[model samples]
Target chain A: MNDTVLVLSIASAIVAGTPILLAALGEIITERSGVMNLGVEGMMLVGGVVGFWAGVNTGSLTLALFLGGMAGVALALVHAVLAVSLRVDQTVSGLSLVIVGGGLSAFLGSSGDPSLLQSPNGLDVNPLFPQSLRDLPAVGPIVFGHDIVVYLAMLATVGAAYFLYRTPSGLSLRAVGEDPAAADAAGLNVVRIRYLATAVGGLGAGVGGAYLTLAVLGTWQNGVTAGLGWIAVALVILAGWRPGLALLGAYVFGGLRGLSFTLQLAEVDVPSDFLAMIPFVAAFIVVVAVSANPKRARRVAAPAALAQPYSREAR
Target chain B: MSRISVEPRAHGGAHVHLGVPVASLAVALLVGAVILAVAGNSAFEAYRTMFDASLNGWTAFSRTLTLATPLILTGLAAAVAFRMKIYNIGGEGQLYLGAIVSSWLALALPADLPKPLMLLVFLVGGALAGAFWASLAAIPRAYLNADEIITTLMLNFIALSLMNYLIFGSMTFWRDPSRQVPGGKKIPESAQLPALSGRLHAGIIIAIVCAVVLWWVLRQTSWGFQLRTIGDSPAAARYAGMSVSLKVLSVLAISGALAGLAGAIEVSGVTKGLEPRSLATDIGFTGIIVAVIARTNPLGVVPVAVFLAAIATSGTALQGIGIQVEVVFLLQGLIFLSVTAGEFFVTNRVSLSRPASTSASGTSTPGSDTAPVVS
Candidate 1:
């Protein structure tokens, strides 16, 4: 590829990766606390619609993103009530959340004037750095030239890695995931921690979804996030639950997404449908490879208590 | 402060098992009604219209049955695997592969073949395709301990892409080149399933047969007992010298085969061609709702699939009343939520207990436990 195509690919990769990065980072926190919420897709959809609607009406990006995240929190709360409070099957509960989120979002989105839901001007975030920094050769557009969300995603990744490894609360969260019974015996509130972690994870997913509408696609459509939520879920496992690796994995997958478009621009004959399969196929192959080796898989295995509902009396 | 404590019950009995799903359905409707009212729609009118469209007349009931044909098979797909604690969410993808493969067989087979034999060939071909698709995930999950949930779901997206590619992107055998717009080539008329009623076809018979046979296998056969044992307690199954890996592979294959049957039925009985756009309806996902509501019982899947199919059949009619058809999805989700919460009650009992300190501060010991004995 020429320099222009290369630059375009790199720029697109960062944009595409941001949403997965944010969502995966959130999931890392939830998974670390031993609760697996598979409702990320549903959460993101709700977030995307709410963000798009709020952005259209109020013209405030911050409100849109905040409300989007809160919508996710609402869905996540349902998951918490079922999986954590009611001690039901977490897998089924999470799936229910997706259905509810998808249905609720679609219902709310389709109502009222169709014109009202469609923002004439899609949400946009201007690049943060100055002209000179963005004008530098090769590295300029790739590194310094992105909206505030990109920088925030990178910052969040660092913050997540540090919080997960450095602080006492993070240690408590890991303890709850690894052995909730032991954590409960050690005076930790297992149920409360799980609820908090799940909510936070929802918050991350919501923001990631908002990013999809407000930045990348910049408009609302039914099922707009289009399974990216699931990809983020898989990325968490692929990253071995590390924030830094999640960032790396997200961009690589994002690069694949970007390449699909870039290759088309170069007039390559590959079908778009085939291009779409690359990331999911990659996700499957890597997941299988990681899982096939018991020793390697064990090192990055999911939390021991993941998806297990913890009850103090039962334990 | 009073505290509510929950403990597992030794046995739930027939009432709890049956009552929970029924009550959960009622609760889901109540919630759906409240949401409709909040959204400025008449809940009663919407329900009345839905009831009229799906169940009031023989013709409407036939349509419901037509929709339920695929739901039953897909529901069984999920039910079978879920019974073994295997979350095979790839029913949607498996269903697609079944359609792709079965439709191919239908198009390629000689038109002169006998009707029953032709039908059997394509139907089994579809099931085999689905089983093979499911095995992709099952092998990794069974042998490598990979997470089937992720693998299966990812395969779903890949499968969808492949189907789209066959009809829309490439000049493949599946595509009808004569059509200006992209579409699948229609199957031979001889391969088509005969209509039993309005839009209902012989596919319903196939679906019902599969469900009954699956019920018998799961309930009466030694293989079924072994599978159930593995599901309930894998450690015990292993201790009993059962081949856990082989069972995992076989069980998932069976699950996929059921979903595949649903896809094939949809092709031969309903759409009569590989209509990718129309087929994208969340039948596979809806089947998950059916399986869960049925509590993963193969027999239970039949009635549950019909009930949900009734709601789905009323979608376009509901839209005539200004309510979006997506409300069906909302109701489905609510039902699933309530059912899952209801499951908690089936296995556990919760009771509120007052603190001992309120009545007797000095006489009662502060740290004495008030835990109830379970079982």
Candidate 2:
């Protein structure tokens, strides 16, 4: 590939990976607090449409992003109420959120004016650096050409890694996830921590969805997030619940996706459908491979009480 | 202030209670109505229209049945695996694989063959294909201890892409070359399932028969007993000398076969060929809801599937009246969420009591002090 093509692909990959990275980071935090939220896809859809709707109506990008995150938080709150407060099965709760979110988004999106929903000029985030910096050599385009969200995603990854390992509150969060009873005994407020972590995760997922709508696609479509939310969920396992690794995994998957577009552009003879299957197939293979070895699986396994509800009275 | 607490019922709460399901449905409908009102629509009128369109006449009822036909099979598929505590979420994929295989058989078989023989071939071939696809996930889940939920969900995507590739890419084999739009060729008329009346095919009867057969097997057979035993407690089943891994594989295979049969029925009976869009509908996922609402009972699945199908049929009708069809999904989601929450109530009892010690601050979390005792 030519240098320009390579540079463009790398830049596109970074852009594509940003949303996934944000969502994964959110999920990692939620999982660290011992709550499994599988409704990321549903939340993302809600966020995507809500962000687009807000953006079109208000013409304020900041308000759209904020509302998009709130949309996600609203759905995640249902998950929290069911999984944490009511002690329902976490998987079922998450799945319900997916169903509700998907249906609601479709309903809302369809009811809106088609013209308003379509962005003739897609929403674009302001770039972090000047055009002059972006016009430099190969490194300039890869590093300085992207929007502010890209940099924010990178910063969030580093912040998450630091918070999880170095902070006292982070230690308490991990303790609650690993053993809620012990955490409760330690006066860490287990239920509160779980609720907060889950909500935070939802906020991240919502922002991720907004990023897709406002920065990536710049338009609203039903099920626009597609299976990217699910991919983010799997990315959590691939990253071994580490925020830093999640960034790497997201970029890799994003590159695979970007490669498909590049290959199509170059008129590669392979079927586009087969190329579309690469990321999903890769995720499946990785998950199966990791889970096949008992010792290795345990090494990077989910929290001990990941899906179990914590109730002091029950014990 | 009054405090509420829930305790698990004794003797496994085996007795059936009609009130629980009724209450759950009522709650869901009430919530849906509130949502409709908030959206600036008349909830009562919309629901009345929905019911009228789905059940007002024999033709509408038959349409509902036609939709329910595949759901019954897919519901059974989910019920079977769920009974064995295996989360087989790949019914959609398995259904696709079934359709693909059955369609291939319909094309490859000589047109001169007897109709009955061709029909049998389609059914068997489709079921086997579904079973084969299911086994792909079951092997890793049973032996490698891989999470079946993730594996099955992933397989659904791959299977969908493969189906699309076949119909959209391979022109000579699956695709109709003459057609501009991407779709597979129609199955031969001789191999098509016989129609009963007005878009209703013989597949409904097959679905009913399968449900009865599954109910009988689950209730009366040793295999069913072992399966339920494993589902309730795999560790205990293993202690009883049952091969847990083998049972898991067999259960998933059976589950996959049923989903596949649904696919074949859709092809030969409903669509008459594989169109990628028609084949990948939410029937498979909806089947999950059916199984859950039916409490995983094969016989129970019939009524639940029909109820959902009626809603789906009405959804299409609603679309004609300028209401988005997605409202049906919204209602379904509400029903699913409420039903799952209601399961907790069915197996447990709640009571209102006062706290022994009054706190001046009144800052304690609700339900934190209420103890639940396993009956």
Give the top-scoring candidate (lDDT).
Answer: 1
Residues B190-298, candidate 2: write the lDDT tens digits.
8788899999999999999999999999999989999999988999999999999999999999999999999999999888888888988878888988888888999
Which pairs in model 1 have colliding backbones?
none
DockQ of each: 0.71, 0.63
Off by over 4 Å in 2: A1-3, A115-121, B11-17, B354-369, B372-375
TM-score of each: 0.96, 0.94
After TM-score superposition, the amount by which residue A225's alpha carbon in candidate 1 deviates from its true location, in angstroms, is 1.6
For model 2 chain A, where is the 10-residue window of minimal lDDT?
Answer: A112-121
Q: Write the per-residue lDDT of candidate 1 for residues B1-375, one digit (tens) a residue.
A: 456655678888889889989999999999999999998999999999999999998999999999999999999999999988999999999999999999999989897889889899989999999999999999999999889999999999999999999999898999999999999999988789999987899988888998999999999988899988998899999999999999999999999998898899899988888989978788888899999999988889999999999999999999899998878878888888889889988888667755555573233242244343221
Provide the global lDDT of candidate 2 against the true structure: 0.85
**Shift of residue B166 alpha carbon in model 1, Å:** 1.1
Runs in model 1 deviating more than 4 A are: A1-3, A115-117, B1-5, B351-375
For model 2 the local lDDT of residue A265 reads 64
Please give, for residues A1-315, the per-residue lDDT of candidate 2 as tens digits: 224667878888899988899889989999999999989998898888888888777877788879988999988888988888778778777877887788888777777456334555447567889988887898787899898889989999999999999999999999999999999888898878999999988888998888888778787777788688888998998888999989999998888877777786666778877887888889889888888878878788788889888877677
